[model samples]
Target: MNHRSLFRRLLLAAAAALPFALSVGDAAAQAALPSDRVLRVVPHADLRTLDPVAVSVTITRMHGLMIYETLFAWDSQLRPQPQMVESTTTSSDGLTWRFTLREGLRFHDGQPVTTRDVIASLRRWMARDVVGNHLGARVTALEATDARSFEMRLSRPHGFVTYALGSAVGQIPAIMRAEDAETDPSRPITTTIGSGPFRFNRDLWLSGQRVVYDRNPDYVPRREPADGLAGGRVVRVDRVEWQIMPDAATAAAALQTGEIDIWEQPALDLVPVLSRRRDIQVDRLNTISTQAMLRPNSLFPPFNDPRARLALAYATDQAEAMAGGWGDERWWRRCEAYFVCGAPFGTEAGAEGYARPNLDRARELLREAGYNGERIVFITSTDIAPIGRMAEVAAASLRRIGMNIDLQVNDWGTVITRQPRRDPPDQGGWNLFVTFASGPTMQHPLTNIGTNMACDGRNWSGWPCDEEAERLRNAVLDAPEGPERIRLLDALHRRLAETQPYRVLGQVDQPYARRSSVRGMLNAPVMVFWNIEKSAR
Candidate 1:
């Protein structure tokens, strides 16, 4: 057999061998299992690193969340809720944050969670390797005043610090005490201790395949009693089995065949089919942002010009792309901004400049630049199935506009290999590409802009007017969350919208398929499992 075929066989063999090592089927079938309801997630990417600091990918974030706890968590509506913290108060200057640690909380190991542990965990994540994806430097300092009182001082005011914790930068897996990890900054914590309802158990089959989490007998959220499953409080599942069957077809078949109990985030195409099944519960949700974006770096030419980017946007067929990516009629809600379009934030700003299928405009702009269909490279992840499908359709759409499109679909590993590196590396391994959330703080305001949109922005798209964008971003940050704050952000969104910093192509319509027993669906956009404990059968 050829090398490719041999590799495929080896992979399949390895996957088959994994279940046997842990006797997964037996463990899953045990009636005594806490998680009689296992949630099987079929996503485009696998959870690679469990070290929270190293984890920023969406897939890893979702899975990592079940085993870790952050300072704060979110409800479906995007409001901040306390998870590990009893209350978080910001100083008037907004430079320091004082958090009251939730009492009676214990990591899976039965060690009580203290302010020291919280500070230590954050410190580890603050190390250059972890938060580096968003922040340039770690926190200036972390001080635990007492056993349960802690204060963090940011180099500058970061109004949305909690949002960052809840998002991608939450703890990475490997259940050890944070104190230990913090002591050795260079050593990555493969295991960790967490105060979540679920405790990590090593008897599981595979690393990313089937991780089994048993109910933490010690898991008692101070505010919410664990007994009230109907109230939708802490974790209810006695055990949680995370089976990584990356293929949607396989996951669906497993659901139908009774091999799995639930699917965390199913393929967009299966929403209808699964929704129609009365035996299963299909929980649907409206998230904050779902649009697949194209990052044409304007820092360099062709892309640097707003007019050029707008022309490119006008040239492509967004509707067609979304349809293909989402599977026929199953795409996400379209959006025009990083915040949900039509959301409070979206309404104040974000109108016009999508360039939506105006072929004539695209032709006109291209002619203005020098008429030619030279090949432009587009980079994306194969693990991101939607983007993969979208890229294929996008290439076709651009081709019709006389743009010779060379789309490169690489592994998620390779796609992000050089992502953290300076763009234009090796003469820019890519040109135009699609990217997702820079982070909660990336919109404007230097603090925010640097999170996602800075030219040095981790997801930078080679835009030239980055300096100008940064200025607007800084202005928005200066404006807090008030009428004036809204106006400032609105103006920044409008500026970026006009510049096509990144097209807010659409917001993903997140759907969770579980047993009829589950509720608490409308949580925040990250799709974390913090509140799932209260959702009952």
Candidate 2:
């Protein structure tokens, strides 16, 4: 396909779109159009589990925002603030830390939040890969100081420990009951229980449409004032009805019709149009999210050699791609850095090491890789705001290099079909689709890359298992967030880049749309809806 031909075909390409069908029924609207006092949260997908340890879905991430409270929560700036822990202290050696738990806290079951429960939950996540093998390995041991106090001893210093605790696994300790123990980690939470502001009525677990939770009156918060937010934020809403409206169109229509109070980014293509509308409000995350997409051609045919994959990856003009497909706006940018606001390890690579847009180099590499024209499938999911547009650019670049390519877009669910751990090929079937893996913890490469996803991880592509990658990954763990970390992470990212572990296209923006009535919309690197407590509607 010619570059122009590819553009024309992709820009106008349409997939089987599931109609976003949600209606603010007249019955509810006429029967006292439920007051703004009740915040109606409309998510693109339904929440999956109450068990914080294994809930990996977007809906689970959303529901997690409501039911669970972590030790340290991120503010608009990604700074850690107190949520469950009243105060925390680090040891002189920088390995052991102690957290003074907030008092008067009660789980949904009315059991007082205790140190034992936190320890148990932490142990569960670490022991069984709740979050993954990395975190479990990091935790040296856990001991309760008292009912409301406990200490975490780490094998190495973690600069982002506060932010790390904000992950689902760490937060599991705070949300689940001490007595609630399951034999399997992947199993769903049979009942929802947590120390957050709201408590769900247990009966709604299987309805698949709506999950209900009400405010926990006994809650006593340990205030950590937010920067942009005005005053103290305690949960005000008596009830929260999170509706799982399957389609974005339905969610958008519901929001426009006043059926749903909040609908996360209706559609990326339509953001500009929605921004012009006066009735609804748009909230963009202040964090500048950018990532490199590294696709591997070396694994399969046509791309059987390392040079072939490298040719495509290097040939990718990220600068233009992000602009053409994503946006020149702050939300998108040439990553250069491994992680946006990259941890200390980012310093090691310095400014020079990052992959810059190099068209000439790309062309040369493509030439070196043996330029026999062959079409390849550049696939991705249409769940977030940016991927669809990006797929077009990738297809364009390959076409520009005289490569024939077909673009395939799949739903997020279908793209990431899960299988048993023993079956890596079925997992490879999932690799047939394109998707992005957003780690709960970004600070630890050992945690993120080595354990959870580096070699043969769930959805890992090109079948990776590099011993050197495993070595560098382990070296960075015990290091602090300073120079040592910089050395490890920079090399890790660079190493992965060289190997073409998985095609890293870009770190796409996770856009969310909130109601005008909603207030205190904070931003973080994660998909969090906890600020719903601060929203008025």
Candidate 3:
């Protein structure tokens, strides 16, 4: 078959298998509608896990925001603002800090929000999140002074404590009930009770098929205007339902037929088709753009060698990958810099080495590294549009460099489950996978989960260990918010180029579609479901 024919076949197969991929029931569930006040959305992924604190997936974070509250949140300007906290005071020595909870806060279970709950939630979050862990290491004590007040006694001064707690980047510090927060951070919390604007309808959640949320009438929202992940979380709608439609074509058709009000991340190939519809409104969801990535496992052989990693990196063609993943070059840009282009630390300073593909160099490196004919397990989730295409592009690039590939296809949830396995490739472990993240997350060292060099084999999916990079990341955090911080971040980027833990497959602008009647969408870094209202046709 020709390349175009193959591409069409792949796209069609993905679409045909999607509607039934994660379904346990018949089409009757898709036809079920609660009421006119219900807002139906087709999310990028099905809600696989309910524990937002345990995992940092985009869909889980959205669900967390719907049910859980945070102490602080980021505004549109990226400034940290108080959300659950009514006031905070810091001592001159910076070693002591105090926070008072806002009045009239009540969890879905009717329990008043308390300082003990906040302390437990922070402890649970600090155990998992990188930023939280760093901050936790500096703290001498975390104590609750009263029913609504808490204090933190640190060993030294820390400037980014508030930002770390308020950040929505990865595994946000979502506040939960004290009992739920006391659960082990390594395990998922089954309970979903919080003081957010919306309450999770656990009785109606159908795992990988559908999830529902109802407006919390008793929950109190901030009086301030909504901005990004901060300010008021007013709920104008009575209900929000997320229906899992993995097929791009199916989701676009649903939007056109008015079966769904919003499609969070539409396939790039079908954007034009959706845009031509009069009732559909396609808008750029994330202005920072999405950074495509090729992650390789450093725990196993073949990829365990930096030379082997460099071989694959040399074989990577950002333009080819972007074209295959997101057709129409206008929708994507070739960003070779690992720190993302247009950010403060984003520069071409030391990225001249990774400008273009070098198949000859790749082969030479592979041979020098004594690469045997072992299969490189390349994983792809056919159900996810961009991820499936990206996997194909990366696999093809590696094959061109004379590497053996064992292409594995599965659902997105399965990929997420297997990405963290430490076993060998033969025993359910993964050697490589293709995924993407928001540009804002990768722009800085502290917020960038990809820059983690924990070396403990438990870093981000593809565990990379570079003591130099880790030290530089600390330097970036310690330096004041000025040019010195920028210098430190750039230095870390240069070190990442040498380490080659992962490769940037370019950047793509993701467009979200909603009904024309829906309005007041926020253009924040992460998708905000607040301040959006739907009117009857």
Q: If scored against the real structure, what TM-score would every candidate get?
A: 0.75, 0.73, 0.92
The C-alpha RMSD in Å for every predicted model, in order, reads: 7.0, 6.8, 3.8
RMSD of 2: 6.8
Candidate 2's residue-wise lDDT over 1-537, tens digit each? Answer: 444553333233312112222322223422453465566676655554455565344455556656666666655544556677788889998789999887777887778888877776766655444333455556787899899888888897656567556553222333467776434544555666787767776554334466666667876655555432211346666666676665554555566555567775455554554465677777655445435354442344445554565666665666666666556355554554434334433332432433554556666766776756655655565554355656667777767767667666665444333311223322332222233334233333533421223343432234455667667766666565677776777776666566455444555564677667666555544444334543333
Clashes of each: 48, 17, 0
Lowest-sum lDDT 10-residue window in model 2: 14-23
Which candidate has the highest lDDT of all?
3
What stretches of model 3 exceed 4 Å from their correct place?
Answer: 1-36, 456-458
**What ranking of all candidate models by TM-score puts the best one first?**
3, 1, 2
lDDT of each: 0.57, 0.55, 0.81
CA shift at 315, candidate 2, in angstroms?
Answer: 6.7
**Least lDDT summed over 10 consecutive residues: which range in candidate 3?**
21-30
What is the C-alpha local distance difference test score of candidate 2? 0.55
